[model samples]
Target: MKPTGNTILVTGGTSGIGRALAEAFHARGNQVIVAGRRQALLDELAAQRPGLVGWPLDLDDPASLRRLADAVRERFPALNVLVASAGISRPEDMAGDCWDGFDAEAIVTTNVLGVLRATAAFLPMLKRRPHATIMATSSSLAFVPRADFPAYCASKAFLHSWLQSLRHQLRKVPVEVLELAPPYVRTELTGRGQAGDPRAMPLDAHVAEVMALLGRQDHPRGEVLVERDHARRWAERAGRYDATFVAMNPD
Candidate 1:
């Protein structure tokens, strides 16, 4: 939350938003450890950036998450910031008879359960720090569901509620719970070529805005919503929830 100087662990740090934040934090003098499922990618990132630590982790596996937490506590005792950015998004056809090809279960496990387990594992260590931050990468779609990715949107909605409760419960503690609701950004989370999509916000530009918001010296709120996402952010408050939902998912 302080922007720099603290040891931070970022899940899904191999690509997309996670990777951008990791690089930015590393550049700002934070001891950044990037955790991802790909060892080669992590190694490459570490090699490319001096002092950037890479740790291989599988968020879907509870054992792997526990091991990662142990390793972090033993290796980086000063770790105080955690970015739970690991997630999966896949299209689901409700009209289809069979669910053989759909990834509903995997999406829920990775997005919801993954965040819960990771936070549980690292929370004790975080609480010990003088100042700590737990940031989860929810999506703007949480407020407005996308028909094709229903499960993904629902998972983020669950996170929105969970994070609010977590933040309130930890209000008296040194830990800070933050939710990052990103708009449709140029990222590979959807699939290949998405990072170059004209409809999506450029990854660098999104990260710049995110960093600027986080670095605010005045008052930093628990939720980080960008200007581009204002329409989705205010859908319910503006009495356009029904219209926005229909517009977001025409299919």
Candidate 2:
């Protein structure tokens, strides 16, 4: 990724890390299109940042994703970057007697299926470009699972494996597959006040570090694990997987 001069499309651009990344890229002189389910939020983001384009998209809907791909191909043929950042996280209590409140299906549908569908839709277009990048937002929990958000962590784990394979298959091509494993960041994904938690990293700082990593030309790898996440990012390799898992999900 050349940092600038590429047309980029970022899903989940309405809020959180996605929005921050879109804005950062836009600031660097790249033409950015922010796509999300909520038209109002997209419009607000567009309003707040002039020249930032907004496109309505529903990652859960296959038709919507296909339409988005077609629209992108027609509107921005030069688009060389696809950031599949849209995701959902929900707390699940397995101890509960009732299964009605569990959100495993929804989490898998959005986080896993959504990324697969979106990538499939845009892959052809991406392949046509001289050079392209496909980036997905995984989580550090993929390496070290969190008890509260079981499905979310599992979905990201799936991404870790899938993206690794995708990178291998596309190694001979011009496409670059990148997985961004973020630590617990202050974001509204889990509800109100989560973004302000002192324990969670600030959104801007996370984005800055991520941007810096992406800006590197010599950094050639599948995963982008930041400094804060380095501990868990290599927990298994560092011979501390069991300890970290127990610590992260204490009874």
Candidate 3:
């Protein structure tokens, strides 16, 4: 995507990387729309940034997504960039007797199916634009797995593969499909504790790097990866998959 002058919509644009990106893009002169579940947060965000829009969205609900699509088409017909930044992360222990499929189901619903559904909803408008971009957030764990977070890792892995096909199919449509594989960042994605974790990359630092990467058009083959994401993202190709997996899932 260009550095500016593009209308953009970011799902999960309430907190963490999503909000940061929305703000960054807004500062760049993009017509920015921020969609999320919390009305209060949306209102607050819009107030903070003059032209930034805040729309309500619940990715797990089909009807809500349909409403978002209709609104985007009506309000921002020229919108050419979509960032599927909405996702949930949870740790599930399969060995537990009380473990049911609920967490896994929820994770899949929000992280995997959510992006697919959103793409379907907005692709028509995107296709109309001469050039469009669909950027979805995957994870460094997508290339490997954390045994404790099986479902979460699997969901991201699915996106890593699915986005490849999407990129190929959208080639004729002239839409660029970008995948964001981020390493552990100081975000409340997992829990509030994560926000203060020194081991995790600082949220602002991560977003700055990503914005810079995009500004420089440094993404190779449409994968927006920062330096820290390299080891996990290429472990398999580097013949370190087993070692990485073991390290990430220590006994």
All candidates in order of TM-score, best leading: 3, 2, 1
> What would the per-residue lDDT of candidate 3 be over residues 1-251, giving only the tens digit for each residue?
78899999999999988999999999989999999999999999999999999999999889998898888888899999999999999898789898999999999999999999988888888888966999999999898888899999999999999999999887777799999999999999999999999999998899999999999999998899999999988898999999988888899
Q: What range of 10 consecutive residues in model 3 has the weakest lDDT sum?
A: 122-131
RMSD of 3: 0.9
Off by over 4 Å in 2: 218-220
Better-scoring candidate (lDDT), 1 or 2: 1
Write the residue-wise lDDT of candidate 2 on 6-100 in tens digits.
89999998999999999999999999999999999999999989999999999887788878888888889998999999999999888887666
Model 3 off-target regions past 4 Å? none
lDDT of 1: 0.91
**Rank ordering of all candidates by lDDT, starting from the highest:** 3, 1, 2
Q: Taking the tens digit of each residue's C-alpha lDDT, what string does model 1 give over 208-239?
A: 98889889932246889888877998899999
- Model 1 alpha-carbon drift over 4 Å, by segment: 100-102, 217-221
Every candidate's lDDT: 0.91, 0.90, 0.92
**Candidate 3: clashing pairs of residues:** none
Q: In model 1, which range of ten residues has the least summed lDDT?
A: 217-226
